[model samples]
Target: DQQVKQNSPSLSVQEGRISILNCDYTNSMFDYFLWYKKYPAEGPTFLISISSIKDKNEDGRFTVFLNKSAKHLSLHIVPSQPGDSAVYFCAASQTNRDDKIIFGKGTRLHILP
Candidate 1:
């Protein structure tokens, strides 16, 4: 079973609009939620992160939220830009358990002109 899942395979948002990507995980032991962005030719890079102890974390135009009870998390990008188009992946890890990180299927975000 996939511990982490991205329900939406793709999402499109107009320029200057908010882009929200959702993720769900089954493991209650997960302590960290991470969002990664992958360009066409580059490996996925860390975008944002939220710890289980906190409900939300924000960086510039990017924000990450974690809902422990719902076993869900989301990444939000404000004023989506064309340059923001990329494949986004949601990941979860139990830092106390081991080094293994579970990744979602990923969602392709299209920033429309």
Candidate 2:
């Protein structure tokens, strides 16, 4: 079974609006959470990340929040733009096992104009 899961296979958001993507994990040992974005042909790139010590991490238009007790995390994009349309993957891993990560099925986000 996948430790990390993205229930929604895709999401649609209006341009200039907020886009919220959710993720959940079954493993309680995961202490780090990360969001990755992938374009049509390019490799997945790091978008945002959070650690168990903190509940949230923000980087410019993107923010990631982690809820340890719930084994949940979310990625928020404010003022969604057309360029933001891509596949996003939620990933988790234990601090000690950084090399072995669990990734959820990517969620395809579409920004409607």
Candidate 3:
């Protein structure tokens, strides 16, 4: 079975700095990787994603990096801000398989002033 894991339960970063969230997976067969941000009582919103063919994908302040060799991936948030504070989850799915997504436990990011 494929499992996504986020070891850190939380991270604290100062405003105007960078925040790095890490994730690891057990299955190399996963073809798609995604990051999602969620607030209390709200569903997670898509942040970014990377395909198995690509190593990196970026959109504005969010970037998703994949390391197929190590079965690892990371999310980078440049110039982190208070508004960026939320619980981030790492997810994986196989495109060829059913659209079942495996999600990590999630990492809560705190932007401190």
Candidate 4:
């Protein structure tokens, strides 16, 4: 079973539009959630993060929401730009000494100009 899964492998949207990415998790023990954006060969950069303690968190054009009961989370980007095209990965980890994170397959977002 996939502890974390990004159902959509890819998403496409026109520039200056809204982009929504979905993610789901199976493990209930995961307390820390994070989203990372990747461009080509470089490693993913931390976009935003939310603890299970909060329902939602937002920063600039990026926002993350967590639903503990449903075991799901999603990322929303407003007025998506062409430069925003990249792979997004959702990760989760337990809040303990072993902060090993589990990542989803990733979602490739293509923003059209």
Q: Report the C-alpha lDDT of model 3 over 29-58, residue by residue, as the tens digit.
A: 899999999999999999899999999999
Q: List the candidates' TM-scores in order.
A: 0.97, 0.96, 0.96, 0.96
Q: Write the per-residue lDDT of candidate 2 for residues 16-54, one digit (tens) a residue.
A: 999999999999989989999999989999888898999
- For model 3, the superposed segments whose C-alpha errors exceed 4 Å read none
Worst 10 residues of 1 by lDDT: 94-103
lDDT by residue (tens digit), candidate 4, 1-113: 78999999999999999999999999999999999999998989999999999999999999999999999999999989988999999999998758689999999999998
- Higher lDDT: candidate 1 or 2? 1
Clashing pairs in 3: none
List clashing residue pairs in candidate 1.
Answer: none
Overlapping backbone residue pairs in candidate 4 total 0
Query: What TM-score quantifies how close candidate 3 is to the native fold?
Result: 0.96
TM-score of 1: 0.97
